[model samples]
Target: MFFRLNMKLFMFFLAWAFALLASSLASAATVEQIFKVQNRTIKRLCNERVIVTVNGLFPGPTINVHEGDTVIVHVFNEAPYNITIHWHGVFQLFSGWADGPEYVTQCPISSGNNYTYKFKVQNQEGTLWWHAHASVLRATVHGAFIIHPRSGQFPFPKPYKQIPIILGDWYNAGVEDMEKALAAGGRPELSSSFTINGLPGDIFSCSQKGQNSETFKMKVKQGKTYMLRMVNAVLELHLFVTLANHNFTVVAVDATYTDPYVTDVIVIAPGQTLDALFTANQPIGSYYMVASPYKSGGKMFDNITSRGIVVYDHQYAQYSSSHLVMPSLPSLNPMMPFLPPFNDTPTAHKFYSNITSLVGAPHWVPVPLEVDEHMFITVGLNLQRCDPATVTNDTCKGPMNHTLSPSMNNESFVLPKGRGYSMLEAFFENMSGVYTTDFPSKPPVMFDFTNPDIRFDLNLIFAPKSTKVKKLKFNSTVEIVFQNTAFIHTDNHAMHLHGFNFHVLAQGFGNFDPTSDEAKFNLVNPQIRNTIGVPVGGWAVIRFQANNPGVWFVHCHVEHHTHRGFNMAFEVENGPTLSTSLTPPPADLPKC
Candidate 1:
């Protein structure tokens, strides 16, 4: 009977490929929204006080969606303080209790409660954002999520307007008087403008240019093709944009998709996100975009830059209300000028190792041949000795009195608090004294980590806070590297890893040998990023596939090096079924 009809046609095509993967996971679709944070009062560099906003907008709204869809949201806080949003590069696959990260996933919907959040945008698409993960109000919340790709599928081409930008970083001494001037010991000022989507634009004029303007603009259309997304929420600065004569083509980042990369200056850091595309075909009118501020390892910033206009499409030209259109730009170092020069660092390591992934497009992925864990961390800053209940004052003005901790492999993480819950509800109620799964994988003492004479190695510049982490083992893969140190300072950091999105695979500078940097790995088509920038003293690597389970949060998106600790956390462990685990919590999570 012809070998039993080809084994009954291979068991009817393996049950019709699992019934079309359970009918496209039962046609996704969930999308909800609510947010509402509160307290708004716009008035950028000309101050009007009272910040923290969400529905009253201030770079807030925008969730859009498609890629498999299932957003939700809700929020509500009403701002007095305590918050938590973070969807930054969302990979909350099994929805790590909607991965928001206050005390790392849940808790802090306080100051007038309300939570919600939900997840799933499965195979991601383009730009991603959403901020505040608690306190210092992420310098005025954030926004933009935008996925799109399900039935209008696109791996490129198809754009006549999308824009978004976001950027941010303004400190007219707001976030509660810069947290009461860093709790009285001093120093919390700098950044007074570098906005782009919340305007600081008309060159912060109070004169030399009659007030008004609020900037922002955009408008495009001279030959179609537009896109832009961007994001970087600049808190501790790390930008380097430019749109003047335009170029981009990039395609995506942070929200994945790549391999188009046509650059002409873009860099970005602080919790990244890019997109790009361009094509206004120059000549029709208005330009000026800028953004500047690329500091390498710190020494005071806010050397202001942030502009934005773009314009064009007024039907073709001639329209100036008050004379504008100033752009020019183009010197990659033609004797230095047009942007990127706050220690260029090889033009931010040639635009983050020239991106890659986008191979055959459409849900690409591939790059996890095998590797169950291989860390090596390191990162920057160190120096403890200043415990007046830690940095609140009382006889400790820092340096010599020490203070700024920040670490990674040499420890310093700490973020526990009382033990009522959070830390993913103390790993879902199994609560073992709040936290500690070890977290080291390397460096208890390694030296010359890019030693510029290792800041007079006081036995390697101090370290040790606690709440450690790094457990991970559920679908595994990992890899890390990171490195970057200079004994007492060094900079560039950015790191950021939450639910997930890795695979940078290489970034270099000084030490990271692995026997000649493992022949410069790029496991074919690298660059995936969920925030990277680690290269001031240099070293990057990355890799991923832990498969999202829970207790996420990994830090250094800067905000004073994540409040002087750089941070850490991973936990993972689950995936042996119940649909790759991590679900429980969310019966309205928030509770500490």
Candidate 2:
């Protein structure tokens, strides 16, 4: 009996030791940050204005972590309005409760409230971002989220230095006031200036020589390569960036590695990120880096240029005297790297199409050979009738006796209204009447999608509004043809999807022809991205597997278009077992 008891104790101890070893091997790294959202006075372009900021940072703080790390951010809202932070490209995996979209995954954290976002970064490693998911707060509430590889070396050699280049828009008036004006049906107000890292830069006339004068400058050592992690956080503009006398080797985009391609100019849409490397090999001097709007569809945009300086430490000292005498910087005098025309759709398409996924890289998933679901979605701006009861004034009236609206598949998406419940919560609770899963897989009415000569009929352009979602089975592969209709405008729509990155198989202008386009799909090495730009008056084919269970938002990243209802959601059913299922919501999820 004594020998038997000793054996049992020894076996238990051995099992416990193995368990500890296993836990240690499987443990993930962790990164925790506390963000305080509050209003702070900042001077930009010679004006002192109060702006909403995170932790008093104009561009917020950058969160850095490894690929297999768990990130927890506790956001304390002290601002006057509601707020939520979205980890733009991070797959929340089973933790859908922390995927922050205003009403999709969770409710906004109201003023004076706090919420904690906790999620594990699965296989993604690159430059993603975080921004306010509510109201116009993202204008100032934005930051970089960088993830490094877990263990292996990067596909490319390590850079000597790395920097985050955030391009944004600036408004002289408060963003809330601009929102109100837009709601009043006033002409869409253009931003007063474009900014680079929260500065108007030395190129703008408003830049002064005082405490208010601001310019983003990067000092570089000679003959060393630097990695620029670029994010276009502009509210409505598609930007083109150029570094005078320098070229970039594009290595990654949207947190996915791509085959390196060299280019002189980089075109980026809102909600997009690009990682490029450039060597400081030019004559050591201050070179201007310019960011300007790339406007399409003949629409007005902020044409002012935002500039940053790339100064070589050794050369700047030698050239300092020459620059002091010349008030105007030499870099902008001729605009060394000429920007493509504002309407250069071909250049934009070329850059986007040239990117191919890195072969055999970590986290690279091949395009699914079998497709379980096929969807055809039409995205464009339209006009719909407004209920008089909800219309307060003439501004509510739109052109041709209708109200301006945007739609996907002829359905203007409306957010479900209630408090303390998100779309996921309602789904889990089996609550009816919040949203419907009857969203059409194709446009309700078929017409010449890209006909430029078609007459504009108000009746044909009107779309019905509803809170609807597309339902998908667990682990089912989905193929969507995003067709951009030429309605009120013909512009490139930057479509962004939350929770999962899809494979962009092919894209082109005009309507999509299955016979011709299906043959064009690059199934072997298609580019994987969380956001893609549907070419102006064109179409794009994308595919993904709905392995993550939860409600995911698919929308045009243009702030105005999303505000006007060009959005939809995917409701993916939970898998049969707990491993593939969504975890329960955290106890601290904010109430509406």
Candidate 3:
């Protein structure tokens, strides 16, 4: 059914492309400039001034192309730092060679250097973005890459007007300093503010420096429907997005147009994108447009960050004129509260065990993954060995639970030599837990995700007695279950695989019972997704065909979890690349 659905969608898109081609052709444009960035704010006192940017913008430019047009993006890195452009979610189906992530696919374009990424836009009309695929710099490097419909038709309903809203979180700390801290054995402080585009504070709050902080603003007509393309580009945190007094129909998710789900509130995680249409139905009044954190772990942190607000007006003008109002979005759900800091009573232990058991029940399974390979990946938290003087910041004490440090196995991977432009690029390449450079060619050294532990103890460490390596043949039919070792913050981890989407086999907590869970597997109507949650202390099994050529990535989707080393890489040798158009990076690319 999924194969048929994909085929039908593909054909429809092709027809739509023909229509678009008949209606209009795209004009190519070159946008370039130098941007000035500074980390002078008191909050980010540790950051340094950076002249790194393309066309004078952190995200370079929005490359607007048609479904069949070719895009040439030249990035010149003038910054003191190394940089590279990664077109995220741009399924390089036949052109996986240019699918950026620095080391994983291609080498990074260095500072004072330039590289051009050229690719044919073959995807159906949808929302996608680009960012620095190297190191932690993605924090500062990212922007929307909008593809208009080809001459024909669109996959989703066309709105009167489209707005590109890139949601991100900004830290005053310098990107280098923050990454250094995280790399040098310490937890980086939680961001004090989240921004829309790049604005903060209540939309109307005056900045401490006497000027108003920029708020993510939008203009809308009261009657016409508007399409908001929202991308949660922030590395960490899931967002619960809601419009004040107005409801929206989610037209698409992760760029895949869905059967529009209507709701006033929508939750999406990092690396996920949503396209929603709002009719601007609120009365002629100002209301907050908010995105708050979807609390998984952590104490009830009341911290609220508002992107901006929607101002509804009775204006019937051609263009709705309005200003953005940033507010502190309040949380509708509080975190599970914390009890006494110190506790070891029998009741407390029993209560904790019961709570763990209750939460450890059947982790919902999405559906069957129809692929050629099944691989088990491990995800857990581990302590970082760091110099006490340099690594131990006041924000966290001894690692493991206090800080949500996650890892795949105990070994936090380091990228092998000669993959990307710089060490930073190499570091980010390992974000997917699986580091190709260092990973063994055979099956994993440890396959514990299939274990039957109901709950992994927070402080307990699980080490395999045997270091003997096990190897699984590439492309073999397999079933690999992932068990979360609740060592880190005991929160569910969304396991995502790059290069292909898979069917959800089965999932549950309390030592996944092979017979029981398998019996419950929905051979039909099971949700097939590229990413699925491996419950904390629970297990999830995923199966897929390793048919696609090139190295693939599998890791936790929680951005922070990824940082702590829940990643690994798989190589799929010699498979037929899909018959699709793909382009190469352009020459004369500008330097950041």
Candidate 4:
């Protein structure tokens, strides 16, 4: 009798499990679409929009999928330029084919072309995003992708509700216009403010006046908790985010759970995502959800550009006299996150250092030795001239290097030094700070930001320089240090690496001594990061395996600084381990 009862229970459990599996499969969402990124007239204003988006919207609709299910996204490009999509922070690790980034792993889809991205959803149940990866095309093409748990395992605290808060910056002048201006060596004007979900601050009023903004408003019940998945979609800005009248606890970042960090304000940089739990337990009221530039001493031009509003209840309108007071936040101080050592043992430390420093090793073989390299550069900021034109023109009229500028071979980076230059020649030959490939493997270099005893032009002012005929090889196992010279800007520079994440060895002020640094390097363990900040007037050492191919961008992560020409690219040639098994671009590849 007992055996019979056990058999019945086992059969029942199997049946229930099968039923659930069937239902989940049945509910799997499908997104079949062809989207175009183009300029269209919205309300008679020539607004740049992504038309023919999923179901015909500017931003393709949010894609909801369950983990362990297959996702098929068929994209067609009707736009003028080629575009590619990356499902950022998604756990499609083994499915590298569908993990997009044009020219990195696959080619972009050209205008009047189509491409299908298919992969299994093996990521943790969390908030994720999708954006275009073409030459900075994310400025217009992006949307949210929310993955639910197939097994009902929760990644965060279950709130009464949930919402995705995508943060993006808008340049109403149009992305193509910005790109054109930047390429032209002129300032690409920007919108006065950032937007929340593509909506500006005064949406209701703006709408009445036939205006459109990106700000999004949320209504909540008193005494309820809400899960906010805040995604930073801005290409370059690191934002300091906060909500008036309420504090939040950050539960996750980049889809990884963190020890709950409670704070009144949160700082999130580009390429970083945060999950915060907010409470609406206060008296029925309204408050502004605000985001501001995280850099310090930013010019005091005050305008409420980064904004959203949260209403506690319907009665908030009745309390017309009540003003939602903004909370006092800790002064923004950019500091490195405290982390555990990467290689604790001495042997492991030595091995790690070898991986970073050894040329021709599997780690470092990819970085190309220059066959015909142009200018190598060291970039930073400096003080400004009292005159506004000099300051803006980067003329440096005062005594010494006035503000942040790019330097080549210990000289400032300058552009178009030749006389009687033609437009075509300037486009290719007259770039500032041009250099040859003859840089030494380890030079005794010095950087003094506090005070300059020696004077140099802020920009290179000579003929274009190119690399020597010989190549300069670098070991992947070795560490590269960047020294920041003096600049008027008090803020530090963010170092971003391309192709691979690197271990940040250490950061300190003053010049770098190769022999001393090599001996003292912390190879045993270091913080692994994709972007790092080299403190003002200081130096930062980064270690990575040069494993990826093609040209990769390495630059100061500060958007504006980079816009001012403080960046460069590295070539990672295929290495021995790089297999001939590598695939070629698809037939629909776009030509830029």
- Tell me the TM-score of each prediction against the true structure: 0.32, 0.91, 0.70, 0.62
Q: In candidate 1, where is summed lDDT lowest over 10 consecutive residues? A: 328-337
lDDT of 3 by residue, 176-197 (tens): 6766656544455466566676
| Model 3: CA > 4 A from native | 1-52, 58-60, 208-213, 299-302, 317-371, 384-405, 409-411, 418-481, 494-496, 503-511, 518-547, 557-560, 576-592
Count of backbone clashes, every candidate in sequence:
1, 0, 58, 46
Question: lDDT (0-100) at residue 227 of candidate 4?
Answer: 83
For model 2, what is the error of residue 561's alpha carbon versus the real structure, in angstroms, after optimal superposition? 0.5
The C-alpha RMSD of each candidate to the native structure, in angstroms, is: 23.3, 7.4, 10.3, 11.5
Winner on TM-score between 1 and 3 is 3
- Comparing candidate 1 with candidate 3, which one achieves the higher lDDT? 1
Q: Which candidate, 2 or 4, has the higher TM-score?
A: 2
Q: Per-residue lDDT for 466-495 in model 4, tens only?
A: 221112122234356776655443344666
What are the lDDT figures for the candidates, one per model?
0.78, 0.86, 0.53, 0.52
Give the per-residue Cα lDDT of candidate 3 at 491. 56
Inter-residue clash pairs, candidate 1: 101-105
| Number of backbone clashes in candidate 1 | 1
lDDT per residue for candidate 2 within 1-592, as digits (tens), equals 9999999999999988886665444337678999999999987766789999999998999898877788899999999998999999989998888888888889999999999999988888899999998887888999999887765358999998889988988888897786875676434667878888888787666784556567788888767899999999998878889998899999999999999989998989899999999998876567889887777784566778888788777543333644642222224332345777888888889998889999788889999999999999999988777667767675575555456678999999887757457898887777777789999999988889888754266556888888899999999999999999888778899999998999999999889999898999999988899999999989999999999999999999988788778899999999999998888888998777
